[model samples]
Target: MGKTTVIHHAPLVGYPDDKLYTVRVIDGVIDGIEEEVEGKYINGYDKASVEEIDLAGKEWLSPSMIDWHVHTKLAALHSNRLNLSNCQSASEVFESVKQALNDPKYDTSLERNLVGINMRNSNWTDEDLFSLEKMNELSIERPIFLLYNGYHSMWCNSLALEVGGYGSSLNHKGHLVEQEAFDMFPKLTTANNQVVDNWILQESKKAAAMGVTEIVDLEMEHNIVQWQRRYAAGNDYLRIHVGMYTPHIQDAIDLGLTSGDDVPHTDGLIKIGPYKIVTDGSLGSQTAFCHDAYPGTKDNHGIYYYPPESLSEMIETGLKHNFKFAVHAIGDYANHLTLQTISKASSKPRIGSTIEHAQLLDIEKDLPIFKDLGLIASIQPSHLVDDRDLCHKFWPGREHRAYAFKSIVDAGIPIKLGSDAPIAPMNPWEAMAVCITRAGQGDEKNPFIEAEILDLETAWKASTSNGKTRLEVGDRADLCILQSDPLKLDAAGLRAMKVNGTMLGGRWTHKTF
Candidate 1:
């Protein structure tokens, strides 16, 4: 292998192939990977006056992680908003609001439109509206929105409802479910390009620091334009795979865009990806399209957003234009219809469609269909732990059917793990830990559906790509150096991994080396 830059004597990790290698790179592409042989090494470059990174034979080199599902722009939006992620109770949520409003940094301008995220009040009874009473207590003069932990529902103040052109009587107090909330997201999250771009840039860098080098952004807006602008502004730390929202597929088609089209005004930082179609609601909102109704309600079978026939047509149309589907289906019935739609589509998506959040499954029946359709399960392991209580309260007796990660893998359907960004966190380490444990790091819920727990090796392989991890000849030189080998450590060690540095195409992105 001949190269201009050489990483000498590094203990290569990840990928099933090689263990120790001196990797050679030429202009960000791997030229050759020479395995350590005969207790010696090989240098593909001039020894003297040539720059090289010596690993000292102690550091562990791993392939950079790829998050298969994320909403890059919205992640930034959520991060910039008033964060309420760890507020376990309703009072804490209100306290957080009071604290944020009192802070001098907090802007009270009506135009600012305060919004909070990651709120979970699972202790509330089913009869509870998860009302906006607390929100209105602060002040109804300026609009405020509080998004539920699952993005399926949100509670807003009276002013927010009024401004959004919805009457207070339209929903429970000021809460909007499913379709209404999703529709409100684009309108409520208005901000100048600079603000959004800055936040996105900040979040992307943070991901690099956490060992992620690539993300498939399933943003609700026109992500192509957003990424183009961001990348043109000289922000190219993360390799973004941009997805157009389901409603905007026509816009992409009108602009003559295809699935693999490179984003304009960027140095290969962005590429077109799937068409995101959310077919069902979430368990948290009690709107997942399940075969049985929610625990308390008799006729509440949950809403299937679109008819299967129409949904299949959309899939076929996307495939006609060479776009895969990242279908969001959380319930058993939703997963059922999604599979049937993919199987019945006139043309197959080039890379095949994936069922996003394939959360719940009717194991005996769905397992075969998963294998038969050869679908890709784009799942998040963190959801299992998060949804544990929701499953108990809303989906009693069927808890085993939810977040069935191990079963999906055993059924031979390919799986890719991700944080789902704002919905979960974008840390792959956390995702791997939760997948293996079926509970969060240090969580005491006793591993919901413990039989579904995956081993560390299984979880890691599912979460990362062989292409990124393996030191194959002529592969992209994207690597991450860790202070310790992940495989050698326990679950906690993996989640608390010390990222020494990150490299993209043989160049350092986050370096402490």
Candidate 2:
């Protein structure tokens, strides 16, 4: 049977249609799909006939991706904070700070000084903060805040330190600054709440155009009021799940906003998610909670964001309030501790429990427990490609335990994929490309455990929640239309596939135009 109709050619139909042998869509929805074969164009039905379209040279079609780990607000604020992060040496950071001081957008009248620096793969030190002579010249002046690429650690300059009253108490390594220091920084924008709320809406729309349908907003600040107002004002366009930051557990408990509350959305606006807790620092920083020293480091094994007992107490608090725990555990020891703590805290498994950034694992020892505990390994595959070298350099002996995707699959643990945007591109195809190829299409060595290169189906599931009721037909038509089938295409081909358009609940959220 043959027929001609306008539609983006995809490998499989997203929904079941037995009566129709083929579907032809005009913009994104089904315009006319022929049920019978051996059909040629008979343009009589003006209302039902689809416009002609040719999509013979494309690949991989699926629903829009759900990047479970993205920070829309933080992503927007990143550009605002770029003055400091793009710096390599302390001098460069200072120069950017000076430039920002002169920028009209930034106000200099604020009492507390707060600035952020972005650090990349370059080496950084406390002295980098200031040359000895420079420090002497700028002694006790204004506050300066420094941020690394990973957003896990920060450096506070001396002048800023005294004003914040953390003068000597803060560690010189620049890794010990707290939220008080973060707050001392100038706000990104001074507009009213509605203006900032509009900012979030604009960012969300941009994410939709990028093929991102869902994002896990892990903001600690309770801008929920802003979201509530914006949502009430008919500004909802994306599916947003928010992680209650670790520090704000008490506020969440006090507000009585328990986990799983379906908040307002102009179109299914907001969904409450897991309670976020940081178990340890990252591996590259040599601050991840590892049992062993980072190869040649002195006696340091990494710092815990909170004491073990405190972590357990926090998990218990979330468990009591019925909030799903989504703890960040990067190192083997940290992952082990987090698993043990959650197991000890709850007798029954929590449905939405997840371990964010399960970057490293003690495969033989830890994989089995994930299945036993029924936790979600919410991970970012792109990080493996970016951090492969660091994993090899800093974690020479533990290469086998790094990003062991196959091992997790073998252990029957359900793993969800995300890009952790602002850190990585928010594109799921790129991530799926990396997941299958293991070789980061850029310059990184392949981190794939060959045996663990997940099949395209699994990778697709990780990209978009494939097995759940949420993805079923008639739930919401939030999906992406791709030019080709992902599974049929090779790794490079998949990465190159074009996202033709996006739909959010049968509405065009993003179009080529």
Candidate 3:
């Protein structure tokens, strides 16, 4: 028989506030849950072997949170790599790179290239956008690659451009956008497998402490093999759904892998996730394929990666293989086009077809279509906290439709919240807080769009798996125990809420008790 455990005085979420409940777990599955009776627990088990935990009605229990979209490898890399997220200007970015070059701490690394991530060029002035001449002035011997915050653009020095075979494609400002930027990513991010693995493990523990139980890792690499290797090396703290990029779609098909299929040798902790495709760029990069032209441009409508017919064909092919689709569509035009493409790809409703970053939408037109087609909207609310000013600048009057969480929910569309980590921090509390307040943490009064703010309940639902609002019997014992009642908290309180414990498969992954 499997191990049995009993939890007493558990304050179950969504349950009545008056009474605390007792929960029973057997081999990572919830067996029973009922009103707690004083000292009346542990039935049908060896008294000595059955472990018991008493919450004393002090903690709140809810399903473990899920980050519906993430690039795990990049997130892991951010821990050790140079972070330019805080640099406000292009000159500041160069100065930081120069400082890193002179710093002895960076010289100890085995990595030959100077790789940096999370630079927001949108915030920089046009005059600050320097050319290769400025980069050359640094006299850097090693290749340098600086990634844009949204992962849609890259700024590389001459050495880096030549190394990535992007010398001929380099623009005046040494910036690469869309496909060129994506193609150069591997060159910049390459490191020893062991070092990468260690980074992943470290990030996993951090995620657990933040109450994350599962992540849909949409890293732009062959994730199956990467995860298999990690699992074999004993990294199993969090459940992972490994997603594939378009380039590896055929590789997955050849291996007979379908979405949600448990990966071999992962101890059921890893599963093959959706076939992910980036149909457009991001707002930060100003390449998010919108309907209206950018502020200065006459007819430039951002970048659209795939033609409509081609996208439809791709979806149709994946659908025939029993693979679920996750397309990245951020701008209004991109979202509209992707919805239409997915709708035309199949006559029947595609159950698990999701639009990742459905960030911008044509509310009147797209909301009804999104609901009717049974497509899920995977959004990252924390993005609004960062992109609120950018949206107003780039999207102008369409700010209301940007990150329209409540509007989507009101239109009866299933919405999932995520961090889009490596872009935003992977904190569900932050995401939930932003969703509820439509403002950044501690800045709750100045909401971006008051009409689109989500309620605490709706935000909580979006954070859990399949929008589960409450814990139930027979569910997997993947749970998060909090120090305070989340429902009673305001936006700031939610953001500051502390996790007392986290349980995965009936075992504690994080515990303060």
Candidate 4:
């Protein structure tokens, strides 16, 4: 591939003390950065051997965003089977599934077909997974599998259930099951290991268009192979950090994979992230483990998913293998327990000990503990707007710390943002809008959580290229040249921000749409 060169002229953000400066690029790294310069082209390589292109002063050159948690192909993987997140009523979900049977959008007869669908709590029932009548109704002339909002749950139609050997199994309510069902879920889904790999590469390009230079891919046990294959394919458009789910921690350790182990691209491109564990369910389902019961509930603290002692043992096992923990703690109690577990499991402070969704926090106390404990809140701000209704209803008296971004920042914990795509869309700008507006446009009935509101810079910092820190001298030249400066744009304007061009590793990966 030929190296494309460019001279950029936008004021750079994220310099020490949040200063702006000018930068020049050679191949894929920042060759020079200066403040108050009288114009200098510092070309190091033989000028005769390099090709150059000028920016024409139309683009705001900035490092791309880095979404720490997102599911790519898997985000839309089951659209053909069922979709829970899209429908407000059970009939809507059924109609959506019914439409997939005859929708010309997909060539349903193709072998190795993958369909993405969404389902909601209202649409699911105990026997839905084994419903032959429903499968017949939504038949797309091929195997079909439906994925739920949490991404952990899967509901297979009769054809999929039969092929995956789960047609007769009955152990759990709705579509959720234990290891057996979880294992079967992936097989029944449209995106097989290989298909998923291809889709992620395509999705990664979309992310690159959004100026996402880096991503922390938290792969499920079955996705490790897909990750390896995609990385080996040599499309280094985005620097990726791979993570192993907790169920695969032992296998990863056996295979000599630990936190920070490099596999492809640069040393940090494909490293293992925290050992991921889901401590509780989500707020939408009213299953987030909380200290206080949900509003309508009389006497339940939700489910703990994993017992404290078991979680501790798991932490100890992970620690022995030099793995950092990425606990998915959505509720206040779940968050508190995960924090306590970390305190007891490890003596010395460990970096990258992230609490996913730290959504419902006790900010005044929890924020400081996270700061002192060195924990990162791997948050998905979009969840706030999507789940606002349930949040208000379920979180009666404890609405204070819900989605408390500003307080969390003030308390001193580094905040990393993500799309959590299958639950929300994979648009950082959408999240940015939520982070700032805290309201879902024109929804007067829904108000922004007062304490959670963040300033533009903080919101920008949490989602932009600086969000992941990739603007050093020798960093990958993955960046987006925007028509408008995000820093200068309003919250709603952030979503409409034009993509002038995208450069991944110094190559023009995508041009303006």
lDDT string, candidate 4, 1-513, tens digits: 245364534545444433345565666676666653455444345556555544545556677777878655455353333344667655566667666556665555433443444455532344233444565556635666655566545555556666666445652222444344457645654445566666667777777777777777665554455566777775566766667786666666777877778754443456666777888877765678888987657887777777778988887887788777778889898888878777776553358778889988776656766777788888898888766766767787677778888888888888878988766767788778777777775652455676567887777777765554336666667777777667777766887877767776677778753
Rank the models by TM-score, top first: 3, 1, 4, 2
lDDT measured at residue 181 in model 3 versus the true structure, 0 to 100: 87
Candidate number achieving the greatest lDDT relative to the actual structure: 3
lDDT of 1 at 23: 74
RMSD of 2: 5.6
**What is the C-alpha lDDT profile of model 1 across 390-479, one tens digit per residue?**
888888999888888888878887788888888888988888888777887777356888988877777776655443334567677777
| lDDT by candidate, in order shown | 0.78, 0.64, 0.85, 0.67
Worst 10 residues of 1 by lDDT: 462-471
- Per-candidate RMSD, Å: 2.7, 5.6, 1.7, 4.1
Candidate structures ordered by lDDT, highest first = 3, 1, 4, 2
TM-score of each: 0.93, 0.79, 0.96, 0.85
lDDT of 2 by residue, 220-241 (tens): 5664554667678766667777
Model 3, residue 460: displacement in angstroms? 0.3
Model 4 local distance difference test score: 0.67
Candidate 3 lDDT over 272-344, as tens digits, reads 8998989999988889999999999899799998898888888888888888888899989998998888777
In angstroms, the error of model 1 at 437 is 1.3
Cα lDDT, model 3, residue 301: 90
